[model samples]
Target chain A: MDITDNKENMTEAPVLLSVRGLVKSFDGKTVLDGIDLDVRQGEVVVIVGPSGCGKSTLLRCINALEPIQGGEVLLDGQKIEKDGKNLTAIRQKIGMVFQSYDLFPHLTVLDNITLAPQKVQKRPRREAEEEAISLLKRVGLEGKAGSYPRELSGGQKQRVAIVRALILHPEVMLFDEVTAALDPEMVREVLDVILQLARQGRTMLIVTHEMQFARAIADRVIFLDEGHVLEDLPPERFFTEPGTERAKNFLHMFEFEAVR
Target chain B: MPDLGLNVLLKGKNMQRLLSGLWTAMRISLIAVAISMPLGILLGVLMTKKNPVVRAVLRVYLEFIRIMPQMVLLFLVFFGTTGAFGWNLSGELSSIIVFSLWGTAEMSDLVRGALISIPKHQYESSEALGLSRSQTFAYVIIPQTVRRLIPLSINLITRMIKTTSLVLMIGVVEVLKVAQQIIEANRMASPNAAFGIYLTVFLLYFIVCWPISMLARRLEKKWKD
Candidate 1:
């Protein structure tokens, strides 16, 4: 449980992404109220909580995928605004992988991966395709270039979704339960890809339902409850010695999950 | 071996007139399709906008077109316009105008349905990838929408083609008109000319529409897989 090495590293690294007093609402009902967070460079922070705790909304607000009622998300000290002049540029720097993979059904795996780099980044087609093919190879999808999304397995599609976001070379990644939709047997493959990404020192903010996976990959674990951060600590500390009574009860809900 | 009373089709010049008449029907639908496709696409895009006036106007246009029969619209454009405006419009030209307006409305509705049918996540995924609104439309939204639209639009085309028989009411000598002419002229020579020639006309329509609906079904089946 000794994570002092990680703690020392966290203090020295600059904050790569931060949310400041973020407030979000839907139809006048508050979902995330006065939420603040900081994710350092080369860090992986996982957010977990009971359903409707606003973890997904927080990630979406970071990506500006949802309209925020108040406050801001910043990357590399620059504010990420929904209507900023350079919003698209800022959006490209914050990659997101969704629960459903959301691959374009009409596009081949290669096209899905290479689209943004070629279209938005204006990278050369040859270069983009070469990189995408190699990345596809790295994700163990060696020769699926021409296969459509419908042709791939859920795990394979999720891996392709990761590559789709990664090809843009974002500063940080936001994963909203990427494996939640995968078949149980397939979930390991997608999680393994994410674990490898963490080993390579990618800054990521993840929302996941897999408690064990969250504990294993996260440098920091944030427990959200009732529209605010209830606990933020090193996974070692938070898992072992969760601060609030709420956190303990939340942990208890997962204790009875039977392994099949 | 009777050819189902289809002997009327082979009579001197009757077959040629039917083919030419079929061509007349095609000309109206084809021109309408060509003109309506782009405008329909634009109007369909406009329909997605949340502006009150745009929604109200498009809704009114759609209801007007759907409630009023095409024959009534044809009458309005062909006879009513000519009588009121004192503009001499040929029957064929009048048919073309009426069909074009009808096709535009149908095409636009198809486009709107296709556009809205696209899942919201597709738009989100595109935007999250740094695609601008226009880029998302061109790269993601439009491609997916068009895929959904093709089968439906082909079905629409088939319907419009068959409905061209209505143009005869406006005095355009399309296929139905030609069939009537042939049946009338053969009344003395062939007792069953009405049944035979009308059957031939029905076969002609079947030949044109069958392949289109088949293509549409094939497309839908392919997408499902």
Candidate 2:
């Protein structure tokens, strides 16, 4: 689809996940309040905001990694959280990559990538190994299977993490500032893996400050201000012409480079 | 008796006693550590919770175990508890109970320190993985905790072996006690046997603890490497 047509069609895309009235408080401070969000299947939705605007907290709540005091997270139009516990069956469909690569250092790179599948999914060793090899290739690190995480560079470790998450074959991937901790030059390599994933039409919900990444990747960009969405617009409109005063002011932090 | 000291090694009687005593001590240590380390790890994990009341209660229990002497604990279990409660109990049983309690409390605190010493980002990253709580513990948090745990546990085993001497006070025939008995019986006829017997006991204790210490050091160095 063309850029203009994609923009017009995004509003009509079927919602794959829906959230409502999410609230989270820590030590008498509200980190998230009355937040609502929707993500369409095969769409990349990037949540952009300044530090401490609760963007990360919002991403966490959606995956039930961080419990919400009040709200609902519906995946495929069904509630993922029932009573108190997060349904593992549902969580299996959503994977997360962190700012710091949490690769298991004790395990070999192949083992680290296959651990979740072997343990959680009870997949056979041969099958899991095959999947891990294919995922390693997909992330452009097939040669590093035998290397330990400590032996790899930060960018390589992050790429390994992306592969680890993708190995689960989740319907949605959550990226929480995945390249925030890397060297400037290394950030591109990590982002390039993500950019490749985007080109494959993987559904993603990302919380990031990389305005250029948000502009280039996101089908829709969400601007959050103080635990609420200030503006939700198509990337072309959101970057070029943000509607709310808060969106305009928040974009100023990106220095208009995102637009050009 | 001039050549008898070295000749004693050829007879193997002393070796038998030494092996038996050492084996008994090792058995006690292995059992104590096996039971206590897991308990301690669980306690340590619970101690780090965000709840203030839970932390305070665990703190009191841990400090009490730490401050009270393990020997006194043995005396209380063997002598005082049997008298106070009208229950028959053996000294060996009491020794196991006291040592396990001591080992557990110390091990638990070590576990807590190791787990907490890990950077907070590690836990956060696991959470970000959408791993369930059990999965997080099994996959991410525990592997790191256990690597630190192995060396610390070996050190605790060594401590437990040395501490088993205190059990002799309540009447278990451990190495030191056997040496004391042999020395007491031959005191008049062989006065220097006191020195010899005690030296033998010292060597026995040294043999028991030295290998474990080496093992602990090797593990620590390997993990570091």
TM-score (all chains, Cα) for each model:
0.94, 0.82
DockQ (C-alpha) of model 2?
0.32
lDDT of 1 by residue, B64-171 (tens): 988899999989988898789998888888888877778888889999898888889999999999999999989988888878899998988998899999999988
Clashing pairs in 1: none
Please report, as a residue range, the 10-residue window in candidate 2 chain A with the lowest summed lDDT.
A1-10
Give the backbone clash total of model 2.
Answer: 0
On the 0 to 100 scale, the lDDT of residue A25 in model 1 is 97
DockQ of each: 0.76, 0.32
Report per-candidate TM-score of chain A alone: 0.95, 0.92
**Top TM-score prediction, candidate number:** 1
Where model 1 places Cα greater than 4 Å from the true spot, the runs are A1-8, A257-260, B1-10, B82-88, B221-225
Candidate 2 residue lDDT tens string, A65-127: 676788888889878663345567677788888888878777778988787787767889899
* Model 1 CAPRI rating: medium
